[model samples]
Target: MSDKPVAVIGAGLAGLSAALTLQEAGREVVIYDGSDRVGGRVATDYIDGFTLDRGFQLINAKYPELLRLGVVDELDFIFAPRTIDVCVGEKRIALGDPRSNPFASLNPAAGTLIQKLGLVAYLLRTADAAKSVEEELSHLGKLYSRVLKPFLSGVFLTSPASVNAVIGKGLITSFISGKPGLPRKGVGALPAALAARIRKIELNHRIDSLSQFENQEVIVATDLTTAAQLLDIANVPKLAGSTTWYYEVPQELTGSARLLIDGEHRGPVVNSIVLSNLISTYAPDGKSLLASTTLDFASESEVRRHLALMWGAHTGGWSLIAKYDIPKSLPIFAIGNQSAASSQFSNNIYVAGDYRTAPSQNGALLSGRLAAQELLLDQGR
Candidate 1:
């Protein structure tokens, strides 16, 4: 191998992961990012003493990548209940992870007793991996409408029918096995923890051409669009987008840490959370922070009304802290398509991103590790 240090473009989670993996293997690695921050799409904006993530994101401590990277215990993680609160017409339903809280989904609004039993049964009996999430859950009529659709549509940022069954499977298993939440510092703390281990990360330094890193192995760990542009690959998966609105409400108005979804599909906001309820540090003393996410952008008044409906409160006093419009959030996995998770782009040049994997932090980290390992093997290390 050449004596020159390995160059990693993009300081996102994928780039950070690749750089760290190579550094651990006794190789010199340097990272370059175009943005001022390191977390990429998982960034957090501190506005008026409130922490607003770039999008609605969660950190699952039990993700194999986070555990493997040994970042599970580094920061203070505020875990939400392993339950989803859905707002049906004129009523709210709480659905819990059957694996851990079997009785949590017992309410009639959740589904019939038989339907709840089928949820557990279907989870045990894995569906065909090459099916659409919609197809996989089509058997449970009420469960699909009342619980899963809104919950998943919020997370995936697209229709369930377009998402692969493998994604649905991953979601079910993670919720069953993992505790999903945000760090006390915010979701940005996740990538920050990973980047802390690596030595060199040059932010606001964009690498436009591969020829610049002369005589050095390079890893393009940028987003799917940038990665493809650098590789001159024209055909790539389409991207998904979302809009999130953050409001500062009175501290007196709060709810459970569980995520709230609009099951009735009555509004533009699909899901929301009382952020301060989950992590108090997200807001200032005597104040509260709330976030609502939607696939389509809605007016500020519309968002406030939708949030009020979900939280069952009057949001007239809620002030807008910040609003995020992320047009290229993640890749939309096609139905029946399998996990990409590929890093073997070329002999000397490699690519890593969630687009190459499953479109999660775990997938981003795993892709970086795979890229570094493949590069190491090719170099006869």
Candidate 2:
């Protein structure tokens, strides 16, 4: 291997993961990014003492990569209730986390007995499902629409039916094993934690070509589009996007730690949540923060209207903090590509990102680590 530090082009989670793994192996690394900060899509914005994330994001405590690195223990994680509130008409029908409280859904207001039974059956088979998410859940007539549809729409930022079952299986398995939650500082704290151990990162430095790193070992740890463009690849996956609206509301708005998803299926919003309820640090004292999501291009007024319907509360008085319209939020990959090789690129180059594996944080970390490990192995390090 060259004496020059390994060059990681991109300071996102994938790049950071690669840098960290290489450094841990006694290999030096230098990171370059186009942004002013380390995190790419994963970021936290602070406005008027409120923490608004780039999107509605949560760290699944049980993600294999996270657990492998002991990331959960590194952050001040605030967990939401292991429950879901389905908005129907003027009320919310609650459902407990079936993994921990199998009998908690017995309350008549929670859900039907058949629905509970079906959910159990689904979880039992979540790890080995070989069908599309929609196909696997099609048997549950009302279950998908009333509870799973809106919930999953938020999860995937697209129709559940269109997603591969493998992705859904991983999500379900993680959720069942551990609760997803936010860090005290924000989701960005995750990358911040990872970046803290790195030695060098050059921000606002974009690398348009791999030729710039010919003198050093390289890892293309950028997003799918950038990776394809940099590597001169032809095919690229379509990315799914969503708009998130952050509002600062009065503390009087009644909210629980559970996430709220629309059961009526009437408007653009797939899901909404009272962020401040789960973590008081997210908002200013005596105030609360609400984060809502929509897969379509919904205007602020339209989102507010949907919010009113979903939360059963007056949203007219809520103040808009910010709106994030991320067009390339996530990429769609082949169903079985999660376990594909991250080490086969030619010209002394390797790749890492969610697009190379499953579209999740776990995949990003896993891919980056795998790519770096493979590079080290090939060098006989």
Candidate 3:
């Protein structure tokens, strides 16, 4: 390995993962981020004895990269219910494994037996075929409105019509194949754990131009916009935006850990969950915490109206804890985007982020690992 130190820009999951991998391979790596703290998008806050993640995020235990990093065993995780609750007009419908909850199998809200069977076959086939999710699901006339649209919007952060089928299949498979859970501490704990293994990370140190470090080995692991700006690249993919609101209530509105979806697409609230129900440590002694997400900024009144529709409980008493708005939340994945391919500006410069891979935590880690591997290969390791 070379004695020269490597420079990793952005202290997000990708940057941290690259730094850790390079260090393990006997390379001295230095990480720098414009923010004072690490885990750029994957951030968490402590407020009034509650752990509020920047957005409603979770960790899929089956991610190969996460397992490789031993993250599954590093922190205490609270598994989310396999089934999801979709709020129709005035009822809540559960959908998932029938054995765990027979009610889900009997819920007519999902669709008729023929529609359900067709939906299953469609999802399975879509998993193998190279089609857009909207293109494939469009054939299922009623099922799209009843089941797919509301459920998928929460996952893709956009209408199901826009998300690539392959990405949808990957997310669905991850959800079904393994348990998705939250770390007791928060979503930030994942990157924090990775950051702990590194010896040095320069915080609040932004790199305006790569020209300054022209002679050194560099890996840009920032978000899409920032990465493009640093690399002076054009026509970068657009990103999805999201706003999450955290509320502390006197009592638990939903007793289960399952996700609650807005089936009707009536308003700003796309999905919601009682964080306290999933992890008791998320709230204080007697209070409960509810985290809800929307694609755009939702006023307090709009949030209350949506909650009232979903919960049927008077939300006037609920206390607003925090509201997080992330403008560049995720990279928009298109069918022909060169997502799986790595970008090499030169032999000593590389770009790594979720935008280069699938848009998920696994993709971020995988991209970082690939960047480090490319560097190692250059060093003849």
The best candidate in terms of TM-score:
1
Which residue runs of candidate 1 sit more than 4 Å off their true CA positions? 98-102
lDDT of 3 by residue, 37-99 (tens): 899899899988999999999889889899899877887877788888888888888888767
Question: Residues 82-150, candidate 1, lDDT per residue (tens digit)?
Answer: 877888766877777666667666676667788777777878886676788888886787788867888
Evaluate residue 35 in candidate 2 and report its C-alpha lDDT on the 0 to 100 scale: 95
Give the poorly placed runs of model 3, Cα more than 4 Å off.
Answer: 126-130
Q: List the residue pairs that clash in candidate 3.
A: none
Span of ten consecutive residues with least summed lDDT in model 1: 338-347
**Residue 368 displacement in candidate 1 (angstroms):** 0.5
Which residue pairs collide in model 1, if any? 341-356
lDDT of 2 by residue, 1-381 (tens): 789889998998889999999999999999999999988898999989999889989888788888877777888998878888887788777776656666656754445689768877987864433556777776776677788778877877788766778877676566667778989989999999989889999999989998877867899999889999999999887788999988887777775877888888878998888899999999999889988889988888888888888877788899999999998887754343345654658756888998777777887888899999999998888
Candidate number that wins on TM-score, 1 or 2: 1
What TM-score would candidate 3 get against the native?
0.94
Off by over 4 Å in 2: 98-104, 107-111, 126-130, 334-339
